[model samples]
Target: MAYKKEHVKERFRPKPGKLLDQVREVMHYHHYAIRTEKTYIKWILDYIRFNGTRHPREMGKPEIERFLSHLAVNRKLAPSTQNQALHAIIFLYKYVLDMPLNDYIDATRSKKQKRLPRVLSQSEISEFFKHISGTKELMAKLLYGSGLRLMECIRLRVKDVDFENHQIIARDGKGGKDRATVLPKPIREDLRLHLKGVRKLFEQDLAEGRADVYMPHALAKKYSGAGKSWLWQWVFPAKNYSKDPRTKKIRRHHAHETGLQKAVANAAKKAGINKRVGPHVLRHSFATHMLEAGKDIRRVQELLGHADVRTTMIYTNVMITNFETLGSPLDNLDND
Candidate 1:
């Protein structure tokens, strides 16, 4: 059955689209990505329901602020969590609700500063890797070896790996920026083996009369045959094709990050390491280890694709945990 929107298929159901159409229309006008639109709508609905099903239209900015504050202050969400909620509400006001969020909310009530990222020791990393295998092992290698974010590792395409140049080209990183990272010396062989398997899969798909692959966004429309091209195939494709809503086409996406997350957890337990290990931990370990090796901070900043030097500066602290080495201003008290 073809469903027109993201709602129940039953004919007698009250249908959700009518309730959220105005909100969706405004977000569409602002050119927000469909994933973001869905997220913001879901958050908005949660906000409304949490406020005793009071219509969001009836609530003021103070109420919205309180809800976000509750997430941070009471629920003790991380800074990223607070920011995600904030971005959703901000989008709802400026785009969906067609109002100014700044008009009612004070500047003093936003998310807190981000602390330095948690990193693992080289030995710890090796032990962690010993416990994982197959897809999870490859995913972790991308995170640590290429300095990729969790999503970036999963979203990689076959063409993104420039073996000739020994670099991994990351497309659609944070802030929609694309950059390249060094391909680790160790994984060159592994990637080559992985590519051969992918080639066999691609050939089989072609033999089975699969006309094309899924290209990113409107690229498929512009070049109808581009999907079948080797460049368009994901480096880590899902086992099956998903039905794309907008075009109603079946396409293979990359593996879900949650699978890698679960893998990391099991590996962490097997290794008997207590610190919470996630894919981002590998990225942090990459940055911190580079800094600890006496690499130039500016270069580390570039390699990590950090926009601000201040963001990169945080990693230096991650490497040098002993604050006593800084020779604190309190030393003047001893002289006095």
Candidate 2:
């Protein structure tokens, strides 16, 4: 009897290096975001150190549970943070080591808390803007007007802003989804002048032979020279060239989020609003204000790029409630 030839597939093996390096190799192969790559690396390193430098392949579910329990009980890590650490370790074992964890991991979990997002009143927003000027001011306006997250506004490419259609295409937003949002008409001319300056900066970079901007996914490899194109240039490019953390190539990146964050905080303090404020408060204010204007909740959900309407519904809880209009029953009781 003749037996048919059986074909066996070989498992993936990373290039020989340090353990962390092999983890990075797998992450890079999967095209993880730079921020995600850094975060996962940090978590993975923390997990290994917590295990007393034991190889992950040598340990399994119980060790994983113990490490996570420590994070919850001792470190007091939030549910999201503990979960992130768990995911990083799972990636190390499943992807890099080719050892899939088949058993359930019943780790001690941090309890999730419900908190309402802080929102600014219209007058407070106006007062806040009075303190911030120049590039940061434009960014702040976009956050309130276009309902963009801080990084979405920062990572915006030149082509993403469509003045003709009065929309800004927010690409690769949370969950890697794209959505269009309103571009405030009041700032169009200011944005135009801003782009003129950005264009001049782009020209200068090209003249110096360092015009490349970071491209997402395989676009850099597929397009090859597209990174140097003006259309692909960052709307808010960093003032100085910095080495790419992954590639080590000198290139200009988007403006750091911390600068804008600090600017917003300072502006809030200067405006003398009592509640805590940051760049995201502007976004929250935008959502609440839009709803206050009687804009449809579903439409607001689309603009905010929330995957669930329930996430968008949180804004309704904080919407302005005029207690005086309701009239207290005590007022109805005549004073004898």
Candidate 3:
């Protein structure tokens, strides 16, 4: 008695599902990063909504190509946006349905345009700082003086700060590469006071059996007891505690970046900044101002942790106003 062909086919097919988490789990199985998981899930959702609730398994390569192409051509999206969507769909087919790519795709890929980033001047930065007050002032100082990204500033751990060495070790920074930056001398006293407050909080949490913070990926795997230790505590602890997604353990993490963002936004408005200002403006100010102070470009590049000096040179163009006093552009202007 042989089984029916339809029954065998149904059993072999991938288990159909509607819940988003099910699809997300398939992407996670490949050890893809959190950003990739988020992007892939979002694109899959967009693909579904774009076609008015069409099932992904039912759709073939043509439909996927059409969606990606539509994003590039119809939506007039930047190349990065289109490529992000492309990655999401690629993950969908490659991991979710166990389908290989590289067949029957007529997607139009957007080309990335090379554009220079905007930078701020030292005086402009000072003016910007004068308008900012409270915690935002410190956050700005860390961003500009340390050349830290906003997330990096917030994510800084207690142990990462080396007051004796006058350096701050940035762990799991952009690209998961660790590097050290100069800790501003001006803020050391204030920073010490701030950390004292953090230490007090740590003591309170320790008393309540809630001292542990987020740990390194392998650390959590190696020692189950490590999550509750003082060394694992976040230097800039979050107001609330959260359970680690990987370890299912509660720990205090860093302050939320959103709070800092909103604070900066409000401060910028009060400061009367005509141009748009953001947490990143401090970073732009850092690189540009360092170059203005006769610091060697290569040294600035090293301090910025740029992979290529050419990327760092873009600030030279942003600093055009600085050269206005270079023996005067009007020295020859009168004769001309």
Candidate 4:
């Protein structure tokens, strides 16, 4: 006797309240980054909650369009943010719910404007450093020196730093790509001394049988012992241990990004040379300064891990040489 098709389908379907878990399992199977998994899940949950907890199985393209329009017209989300939410919903329909979205989604798209990045002068950078001290100060130097995004600087591990070569191997940067950037000579000794303190902390953690730090890509399972090793430890470990959601393993993760951001903001305010400075401003300053110092634009693109040269070209607009090189037609008329 043959089994019924409906019975087979029912056996395979997820049980109630397990839909999100299924989404996570699919995301993990495809090797989506942890951040992406979190973001997608958040948007999906918000979408469900916004529609009075209606199952996505009952929703279609029309519902998705209205939700996206609400985000733009009501929440005033950035275009990028609105687009991200749309992608998350699309993924849910296509993958999780097994429903296909239309080729075109009609919605009120958030209007995004082009804005030039803010850069700090060399003197302003010097003043900004005066207010921050210790680890926060070192982190700022790394951001400006290496042109690292805030997450890239904080996510660094011991193995990623190359002192002898004067470079930093930034792993899993934006768009899930890696690139190398120069590690300024001025911060080398300070970084070395800071590592000495981190090493002591790691030793203490090991003594307490809690040396394990968070590892990605199932690396902890593959190596079995790498998570507890000094080489894989966070270069900037958090002061306290937290429970990992998946494994419930108590581990010391990286320093929270917000803490460093707030520290930088306070430092900028204390220095009183404000042009809306933040950790990212330091990165912008790095790219702009490299261009000003005659570094090749292509080389800057590589160091900054920009996928397109056009993104790096934005710095050229803010460079002082653009004005310095300009000569008015009135000035040239003197020759006539």
RMSD of each: 7.5, 5.9, 7.5, 6.4
Position 35, candidate 2: lDDT: 87
- Which ranges in model 4 have alpha carbons more than 4 Å from their true place? 1-16, 28-34, 321-336
Candidate number with the higher lDDT (1 or 4): 4
lDDT of 2 by residue, 1-336 (tens): 011121213446899889888988877777778888789899888878899988887888888899999999999988888888877777777778888777788888887788999999999998999999999999999999999999999999999999999999999998789999999999999999999999999999999999999999889999999999999999999999999988999989999999999999999999999988988999999999999999999999999999999999999999999989988989899888
lDDT-sorted candidate list, best first: 2, 4, 1, 3
Candidate 1 per-residue lDDT, tens place, 1-336, comes to: 011122212222222465477666655444445677788778788777778888766887678767877776677776665666667766555554555454544422435666668888888898999999986798889899878998888888888899999999888777768988889989999988988887787777777766377566567678988888887787887777677644567666667778998998889889988898888899999999888988898888877889998898888777856567867788768764
Clashes of each: 0, 0, 1, 0
Q: After superposition, how far is residue 229 of candidate 3 from its true place, in Å?
A: 3.0
Deviation in angstroms for 221 in model 4? 1.7
The TM-score leader among the candidates is: 2
- Order the candidate numbers by TM-score, best to worst: 2, 4, 3, 1
- In angstroms, how far off is 176's CA in candidate 1? 1.2
Model 2 TM-score, 2 decimals: 0.94
The Cα error of candidate 1 at residue 243, in Å, is 2.9
For residues 181-268, what per-residue lDDT tens digits would candidate 4 score against the true structure?
Answer: 9989999999999999999999999999999888787686799999889999888999999987667888788999998999999999
Q: Which candidate is the best by lDDT?
A: 2
TM-score of each: 0.81, 0.94, 0.82, 0.88
lDDT of 3 by residue, 180-288 (tens): 8889999999888888888888889888988766656456568887766655566677888887664577867678888888877777777666767778877877888
